[model samples]
Target: MANRTSRDVLLRGLWVLGQGIREQPGLFTVGVGGSVVFGLLTIASAYVVGAIVGEVVVPSIESGRVETGLLGAGAAALLAVSVVKVVGIFGRRLGAGFMQYRLQASYRRRVTRRYLDLPMSWHQRHPTGTLLSNANSDVEATWFPVAPLPFAVGTVVMLVTAIAALFATDWVLALVGLAVFPALFALNVVYSRRMAPRQVRAQQLRAEVSGIAHESFDGALVVKTMGREAQETARFAGRAVELRDALISVGRLRGLFDPLLETLPSLGTLAVLLVGAARLRQGAVSVADLVSVAFLFTVLAFPVRAIGWVLAELPRSVAGWDRVRHVLTATGEMPYGDTELPAAATPASLVFDRVWFSYRPPVGEPAAPATADQSVDPTAVGVPGANTALPPVLRDVSFTVPAGRTVALVGPTGAGKSTIAALAARLVDPTAGRVVLDDVELPRLTAGSLARTVSLVAQVPFAFDDTVRANVTLDRPGLTDEVAWSALRLAEADGFVAALDDGLDTVVGERGTTLSGGQRQRLTLARALAGQPRLLVLDDATSAVDPRVEAAILAALRNSEIATSILIVAYRRATIALADEVVYLDQGRVVDHGTHQELLARCPGYNDLVTAYEQAEAERERTRSGTGTGDSGGGDPGGGPARAAEVVA
Candidate 1:
C-alpha cells in the first residue's frame, strides 16, 4: 500500500506541476531561469573570491604593494553578484505566485469535478468531513511538492556544480564533501519511509475531526433537543485530539531529522577545515585554493541540505496526493449516458430489467467494499491492519413506472424505497441488471440529458447561504425572477417567501437555518420544479411541513400540466392517495404494484403502512392542537422517520 500510494502520489504531483508549467509557460520559465541564474551567480562569486585572495590579498601582503585597481575590480564583481541575486529573488517570488494560483485553481476544480461525478452511493459511504478535509488540507499538502520542485532542481544542480568545482581544485576535498551526500540522502530516505504512513493516518484523523465537527454544527438542533450536547462535544474533542497527537508525531519526526540534516553539513565543513589546514602547513595546497574550496563548500552545503529537506517532504506530499488521486481516479458511479434523449417536455417512461445492486462503503483499507450481506466478518477477512467489508444496503430489486403516471413506493425503513427513487434518477446504479429511461439504458444517457429528463427532490433539500431568489433558481443561468416566482407559487412556497422581510432577496442563512422546517421544504420543492424535468422523483418531500401545506402542494402537483412521470416515496396516506399506483417493496424485492384501492384490497402491508401513517399524523396533529396527553414532538413517529425528498418535475 505504501509503495503504491507513493508512486500514485508522486506521479500525480509531477503531473500537476507539469500542467502548471504547460498553462503558463512564461511564469514557469521565469521560475526555472531564475534558479539557474542564481546557481551560476554563486559559482561566479566563489571564483572571484578565489581570484582576489590569490592576485590581490596575498601578493599585496607579501610584496607590500597594495593595488587599488585590483580592489576596485573585486568591488565591481561583488556588486554584479548582488544585482544578479536580487533579480533572481524577485523573479522567483513573482513566478511562484503565478504558479501557485494556477495550480490551486486547477486542483480545486479537479477535486470538485470528481466529487460531482461520483455516485450518490459512493458519497453515502464516506463522511462529509473527510471530503471537506480532502478538498482543503489534502490539496494544500499536494501543493508543497509542486511549489518546491523548481527550488529542489536548482539546489541539486548547484550542489553538483560545487562538487565538480571541488574536484577541479583538489580531488581529496571534493571526495570528502561528496561522501556526505550519500549519508544525508540515506537518512532522508529512511525518515521519509517512516513518515509516509504516519502522515496518511494523520490526514485521515484530520478528516474525521472535520466530519465530526460538521455533523455537530449541522445537527445542533437535534443535539440540543436530545440533551446530548456534552456527549457530542466530547466525541468531537476526542477526534480533534487524535488529529493533534498525530500531527505532533509528524512534527517530532521533522524536528529530529531537520537538525540531523543541518548538522551533517556542519560536520563535513569542519572536516574540510581541518584537512585543508594540515595540507596548507605541508605546502600541498595554496591559500587561494583553500579559500575558494571553503567558499564553494559553504554555497554547496546549503543547497545540499535544502535538497535533503525537500526529499524528506516528498513522501508526505505524495501521501496527500494519493488521497486526492483516490478521488480523481476513482471509477465513476454508474456510467455516463451518451444516447440522445427527447427534447420534448413530455414524461419519459422508466423500466427496470432484472436489476441487482449492493452498497460498497469505505471501510478500513483502500479496497472496494464487499457485498452487504455476505458476512465477510471484518475480523476474519482482515489483512492484519486492513478491513474493507461494507454493510450492503440494497440487493436485487426490480419494478417499473410508466410515463405520464404516478407511482408510490411503500416499504419499511432501509427496505430500499429511497434507494429505488435514487436509482430512477440515475443518482446511483445497480450492481446487476439495467435501469432504462424510455428504452435507453440510464448509463448510456448523456449527463445533461439525464439531468433534464430525471429530476429528483430528495428528503432534506440542501439550501445554500444565499438569497431566496438564488436558492429558488439554484444559480441556473437564464432562470429569470419571473420564472423563479412561478416555481415558488407552484410549490406553495410563495406565501411564506413573500412574508419574509426581504421577500425573494432575503438571505436563507446556512442550510436555511433562519427558515422554518415547512418553508425550507417548500423552497427545495420550488428549486426542483424550476427545471420542469420530465420525470419527477420525490422521496417524502412533504414530511416536515404541516398537513395543510402538504395537501396544497400535492394538489398543485396533481393539477400541474407537467405531462411527466412522478414517483412519490412516502409513508403518508395523503401522498399515497394522490398516486395512480403503489409499488410495495419488502426486503429487497417488489411485493406488489397497483392503485391505492387495489393495493389496499390486495396487499396487507400496504394497508398497514397507510394505517401507521394515519395514526402517526393524527397523533402529531392532536399534540400540536393540545388535545393529546402525549409529548408534543411525538419523540418518534409510528410510520418511521419522514425524509423530505425532491420533486423532480
Candidate 2:
C-alpha cells in the first residue's frame, strides 16, 4: 500500500510536469534544442582532438615539418565549435530559467486563488504558516525539477550521441563505457529512496518554523507583556534547529551520492584504456581510434552527471508537489452564489432561522465539514479548546433586526455572541439553518454583494502600514475627504485624526502599532463606516474605548444620518443602552430578549449577568481610585450599573 501511494505521488508529479511542458512547449524546445546543439558540439570537440593527434601532431613529429594550413584548419574548426557552444549554452540556461520562472508564477497564482476561495473552516484547519509556504517554498520546491528537466533531455541526447561515437571509433571500448550508465542509474535510485523521506520531513519542518515565527511576531505584544520573550526565543530556536538538522541529513545523503557519481566515470575511463591497449596490440584499433574512444568517455562524464542531477531532485519535487496538491484538492470550499444583489439598493435585514452551528478543532488533513448530525450542542461543548466532539455554539436560535435598527448581543464570555455576529456577516454559514439579509439567504448572495451590503468590524482592529486616509478608505476609489471626514466623525475618530502630524495622510505603522488600542478600534470602525454598508456588524468594536468616547460614538451611530442596520456585540451598559433591543444569552442559547428594562424585569439570567458586570466595574473603579488615577469622565464608572440593577430587581 505504501509503495502504491508513493508511486501514485510520483505519477501525479509527472502529470503536473507534463502539463507545465505543454503550457510552455516553446521554452522546452529551446532548452532541448540547445542540448542537441551541445551534443553535436561534444562530438565535434572529440573528433577535432582526434584529428589533431592523428592527422597533425603525430605526422608533424614523425616528419619534423609543421604544416601551417593543417594547424590553421584545426584551430578554425575548434573556434567555430566554441562559438556554436556559446549559443547552445545560452539556449539551455535561458530556456530552463524562463520555464522555472513561469512555473513558479503560475502555481503561485493558483494556490493564492485556492486560498481565497476556500471557506473559513478550511482556513481554520490549516495554519497560516503552512498556507504561506504552500504559495512560496512548497511551490518553489515542486517546480525545482523544471530547471533540470530540459537539461536532462539534453543529457539523454548527449548519451546517445556519445554511444554512437564510441562504437564508430571502436566497438570494443564502447561496450566498456556503456557499463557505467547502468551503475550510475542503480546508484541514483538507491540514493533517492534514502533521501526522499528526509526531504519531506525537511519541507514540513520549514513550514513549522515559518508558522512559529509568524505566531510569535503576531503575538509580540502578548509575549512582551507576559515577559515570555526568552521562552518564545527558545521555542523558535528549537524548531529552527530541527529544520537545520533535517537539511543536514539530506545534505549528508547527497554528499555520499556525489562522490560515487564522480568516481564511476573515471573507472569507466580506466576500463576503456586497459581494453584499448589490448586492442591496439592485437591490431584491432589505431591510435587515433583509441584516442577518440577515450575522449568520448571524458565527454560522456558530464552528461552522466547531468542525468544524476535531475534524478537527485526528483524525490523533493514530488514530495513538495504532493503537499501543494493536497491544498488545491482540499474539500469544504463554500459553494459561492451567483446571485448578485440588485444594484439599485441592498435591503439589509439580518435574521437567524432555527440556526444551529458547531466548530471542532481540526485533527488532520481531509477534515469533514460541519454537518447536522455531527453538530455539537453549545450547552455541552464546554469551553472550546482541543476537545473535538463539542456542542454547538448556537442552538435553535432565531431572531431578526429590521433595517435601520440596532440589536445588541448580550451574553456571558462564551455564550456564542461572536458566533451570532459571524453568522450575521456570513463569515461562516450556519450548520443547520440560514442567516437571511434583505429576504435573501446570505449564502445566496454573491461575495461582492455580501461585502458591499454587510460589514463586520472586529474588536482588535488591523491596519496596514499606510496613511490614515488610505486605511480609512481601504484603497476604495471615489472616497474623498468629504466621505472620510463624515465617517470619522461618526466613529468619533476625527479628534485623533486632526491631532496627527499629517492629518488624514499620517502613516499608521504595521497593524496600527503607532496608534493606541482605542485609536485602532475607532479607525477600524471608521473604515467600516466609510464603506457606508447597509448592515453593520460590530463584535465588541468599542470595548477598547473609554466609556465616554464609546458613548459618544454610539450616540453618533444612533443619530447619524446613515440608515444602516447595526448588530453589535456589547457588554458595557452604555453600549447596550444605545441599542433599541437587547438579546440576552446564557451558555449558547438566547435566554430572553427584549428591551433592556423588559428583560431586566423578567429574565433572571439577563439581570444577573448585568449585575455581574456592575460589580466588576465597581471593583475596577475602586482599584483605579486607590491607584490615584481615577478618571470618572472616561466610563460611567459604577453609576449606571447599580441604578440599572435596581430597575431590574
Candidate 3:
C-alpha cells in the first residue's frame, strides 16, 4: 500500500516536470538522446565481453591453439567501446548540465513573476527566506531527477539486452536471472516507499532552518543591540540541529539501500555461475555457453547498481519537483476584471466605499493532551480539528482623497493604518467593499496602469544592495541623471547624497546598511517621486528623516502644484498638520473625518491623540535638555533640525 502511494505521487510529480520539458522540445531531445547513446554503448561493451569469452578464451584453452586474430579483434573492440563510452558520458553531462541551467533559470523567473502577482497580505505571513529558498535551493534540488532518470530508464533497456543474450544461450539460466529481478525490484520499491516521507521531512526542515538563518542575519544588529545574542543563537541552533537530525535519519536509510542494491546483483551472478557450472558438468551446457553466461552476468551487474542509485534518488527529486510545482500552480494576486482603467489626462480622485478587511489567520493546530503520556496531549497543538477559526484585523472603513490633495491616517499601532494604505495602492484588495480610482474599481486596473497611478512609500523602505542611482530608479527606466538628482533634492536628500565619496554612484551595502535610517527613508521618497505618480501614498515615509528635513520635503510637495493626491499614515500631528483632511481610526473603524481644526473641536479621540503627541514631544525634549544626549531612540533624524526651522505653510 505504501509503495503504491509513493509511486503514485512520484509519477504525478514527474508528469508535471515532464510537461515543462515537453514544452521545450529541443532541451528534452538533447537530454533523451544523450541517455540513449550512453545506454547503447554500455550494452555494446557487454556484448563484446561475452563474445570474446565464448569465441576466444574458452575455445583457445580447449584446443591448445593460439588465436592471435581473436585476441586482436577483442582488443580492438574494447578500444572502440572505450572511446564511445567516454563520448557518451561527456555528451550526457553536457546536455544534463545545460538542461539544469535552463530549467532553474526559467523556473526562478516564473517564481518571481508569481511573487509580484501575490498581494501584500500574502507576503506578511510568508518569510523572506522561505520564498528565497524556494526560488533557489528548492528549484536547484529538483534537477537531480532530470539527470539520472533518462539514463536509469536506458539501463532498463540494457537489462532487456542481457536477458535476450542469456535466453539465446540457455532458457533455464535466463529464467533464473529473470526470477532474481522481481525480488530486487520489490526491495527497491519498498526502500523507496519508506524513505520518501523521510526525505520530504528533511527538505522541509532544511527550508525552516534557511528561513531562521536569513531572519537572524537580516536582524543581526537588532539581536545584538537588544542583548539577545544568546537567545537568538539558541533559537537558530535548535532549528539547525533539527535539520541535521532529519538529514541523518534519511542518510542512514540511503546507506542501507545502496549496499543492498549492489550486493543483491552479486547474488544473481553467483546463482548463474553455480547453476551454469553444474549444467556444464552434466553435459547439459557447452563450455562456450558457460563462459558466455558468466561474462554476461559480470557485465549486467553494474547496470543493476546504476538502476538502484536512480531509485534511491527518485523520491527526493520528486519531492523537490512537487515543491516547485506548488509555487508554479498557485493562483497569484493579479487583479481580475473585464474593464480597464483609462489613462487620465490629469490626476484623479480616490474613494473607498464601506471598506472592510481582515487577515486570513494561519491555520491552527489541534489541542494536545494535558500530560505527555497521552496520545493527544492537552497542551500540544496539532493540525486543526475543524472547530476553530481565525479572527478579523479590520472592520468597516471608508474615506476619500480629492485630486491634488493630502489626506492623513492616524490610529493606534494595530488600528489597520498600514492595511488601509496597502489597499489604496491595490497591494491588497478589500474583502467586502470597493476602492475606486477615477471611478474604476481597484481590481480592474492592470499592473502597469496601477503602478503609474499609485506609488507607496512605507515606514520601512526597502533598499537594494546597488548603486544609489540604481536603487532609486529601481525597475523603472528612462530617468536621466538630472531627473534623478531633482527627485533626490525634492526629498531633502541631495545634500547628504552628494557628500558620499562616489556621489550617486556609491554602492549601498545590503539593504542600504551604509546609509543612516533617515537617508534610506529619504531615498525611498525620492524613488516614489521619480515615478511621477498620480497618487503618492506615504505610509510613515518620513519616520526616520529629521522632522526638519521632513518639513522641507512636505513643503516642496505642497508648493510644487504637481497635482498628485497624497495619503500620509503617521502618529505625529506635525506630520499631517498641513493635510487638507484627516481620517481618524480607532480599533479598525473610522471615527472622525475632517480638517485638523474641525477634528480638534468635535472628535475627542482625535483631540486626545494630538494632545498626547504634543505632550510626549515636550517630555522628550525636556529629557534631552536635562541629559544633554539629544536622543530618544525613535525621533526622526531630521526632526530636531526641521523643528527649529520656519515652515512657510
Candidate 4:
C-alpha cells in the first residue's frame, strides 16, 4: 500500500511537470536541447582526456621526448570542448529560470483573477492569509521543480549513453555501471518516500503561520488597545516554531540522502578501476578504455544527482499544486448576464420582492432545509445553502425606494440591515425572490450595467494608499478634478482636502491611516458619489462623522442637482428624519413602514428604540458641554418624534 501511494505521488508530480512543459513548450524544448548538448559533450570530454593520456602522454614518456605540436593540439581540443560546454550550461540555466518564473507569474495572475471572480460569500469563508500564500509561496513551489527538470532529463540520457559506452568498452565495466545506477535510483526512491510527508507538513505550516501573522497585523489596533500583545505574540510564535521544526525535518532528510547519492558514483569509479586494471593485464581492455570509464564515472556523480533533486522536490511540488489548483478551480463564482440597462441620467428605483437571504454555513456543517415548503433551485443566483436550514437573514422582506427619493432602513443590531443594503447594490443576489432595479431583476442585468446604476458605501470604509484624486476617481475615465471636488464638497470633506500640502495629489497612507476616521469615511463617501450612481446604498457609512456633519451630508445628497435614489441603514434620529420614508425592522422582519413621526406614534418597538437612542445622544451632548442638566426626558435637547417632525417639516 505504501509503495502504491508513493508511486501515485510520483506520477502526479510528473503530470504537474508535463503541465508546465505543455504551457510553455518552446522554453522547455530549448532547455532540454541545451541539457542534451551539455550531456553529450560531457561524455565526449571524458574520452578526450583519456585519449590525450593514452595517445600523447604515454608515447612521449616512452621516447623520453616531448612532441610540442601534438601536445598543443590536445590543449586546443580540450579548450574548444570546455567553451562549447559553457554555452550549453548557459542555455540550460537561462531557459529553466525563464520557464519557472513565467509559470509562477502566470499562475499568480490566474489565482488572483479567480479570487476576484468568486462571490463575497466565498471570500468570507476563506482566510485572506491563506489566499495570499496560495498566490505567492504555493505558486512558487509548484514551479520550483521546473528548474531541475531539464537537467534531470539530460542526465537520464547521459546515464543511458554512458552505460552503453561502458558495454562497448568492456562488459565487466558495464556490469558495474548497471549496479551503481540502479542503487542510486533506489536510494532516491527511499528518500522521496520519507520526504513527502515532511514537505507536505511544512507547506501546511507555512500557510498557517501566514494566516496568524496576517490576522495579528490586520487587527493591530484591536491587539494594542485590548493589551493582548503578549497573547498574540505567543500565538504567532507557536505557529512559527512548528513551521521551523517542519522545515528542519525536510532539511535533515535531504542532508542524509545528499551524501549517499554523491557517494554512489564515487563507489562506482573505484570498482571500475579495480576491475579495469585486471582487464588491462588480461588484454581485455586498453589503457584508454580503463581511463575513459573511470573519468566518466567521476563526472557522472553530480549529473546523476540531478535526478535525485527532482525526485526530492516532487512531494513539495505536488502539495503546492494541490493548493493552487483548489483556488483556480473554486466554484460559486457569481455569473453575470449579457442584458444591459439603458443609460439614463435620472435616478434608478429599487424594489425587493419578498426577498429571502441566508448566509451559508462553511463547507462541513450540517445542511438542513431552509424552509419546510420552500423548494430551492440549485441554479438560482449561485447562492449556496438555499436548501440548508440556516435561518434566513431576511425573510419575505418587501420594500422599495422610488426614484428621486430617500428611504431609511431603521433596525436594531442583527436586523439584516447590511444584508438589505448589499442586496440593494446587487453585491449579492437574493436567495429567493428578486431584487429589481429600474424594473429589471438584478441578476438579469450585466455587471457593467449594475455597477453603473448602483453604488454601495460600506460601514467599514477602505481607502487605497494613493493620491486623493486617485482614491476618489479610481482612474475612471472622464472624471477630472472638477468632478472629484464636487463629490468631496457633497460629502463635506472639501475643506480639509484643500488644506493638504499637495491638495488632491497628496498620497494617503495605507488604508488612509494619515487621515482621521471621519476624514476617511467622508473620502470613501465622496468616492461613491464621484461614480455618479443612480442608486446609492449607505450601510451606516457616515457613522464616524459627527451627527451634525452626517445630517448635512445627507441633506446635500438629497438636494444635489444629480438625481439619485438613496438607501440608508440609519441609526441617528436626525438622519432618519431626513429620509422621505422609513422601514422599521426587527430580527430580519419588517415590523412597520411609514414616515418617522408616524412610526414613532404608532409602533411601540420603534418608539422605545428611538427614545433610547435620543436619551443616549442627549446624555452624551450634556457630558461634552460640561453641563449637569441631566435631562433624559422627551423634551430634552436630543429630540424624539416632535424634533424629527421639525427636521422633516
Predicted structure with the largest lDDT when compared to the true one: 4
Expressed as tens digits, the lDDT of each residue in 570-600 for candidate 2 is 8887678889999988767778888888988
1-649, model 4: which lDDT tens digit per residue?
8788788888999999999999999998888888988998899999999888888898999999988998998899899999989888988898898999999999999999999999887776678889999999999999999999999999999889988888888999999999999999999999988888898899999998998999998877557656789999999999999999999989988888898998999999999999999999999988888899999999999888889989999999999999999999998877888888878789999999888887776545665555644444434445555655366788788999999999999988899999999888776778887898889988888999999889999987788999999999999999999999999999998987998889999898898777766677789999999989999999989776667888888989988987799999988899889999999999788999999999999999998888887787766665645744322211132333322222221
Worst 10 residues of 1 by lDDT: 640-649
Per-model TM against the reference: 0.82, 0.89, 0.86, 0.91
| Global lDDT of each candidate | 0.74, 0.79, 0.74, 0.86
Per-residue lDDT for 211-254 in model 3, tens only?
A: 88898997765665567789988999998998899889888988
Better model by lDDT: candidate 2 vs candidate 3: 2
Q: RMSDs, each prediction? A: 6.3, 5.7, 6.8, 5.9
The CA lDDT at 360 in model 3 is 46
Question: Highest TM-score, which number?
Answer: 4
State the lDDT at 430 in candidate 2: 73
Which of the two candidates, 2 or 3, achieves a greater TM-score against the reference? 2
Evaluate residue 226 in candidate 3 and report its C-alpha lDDT on the 0 to 100 scale. Answer: 61
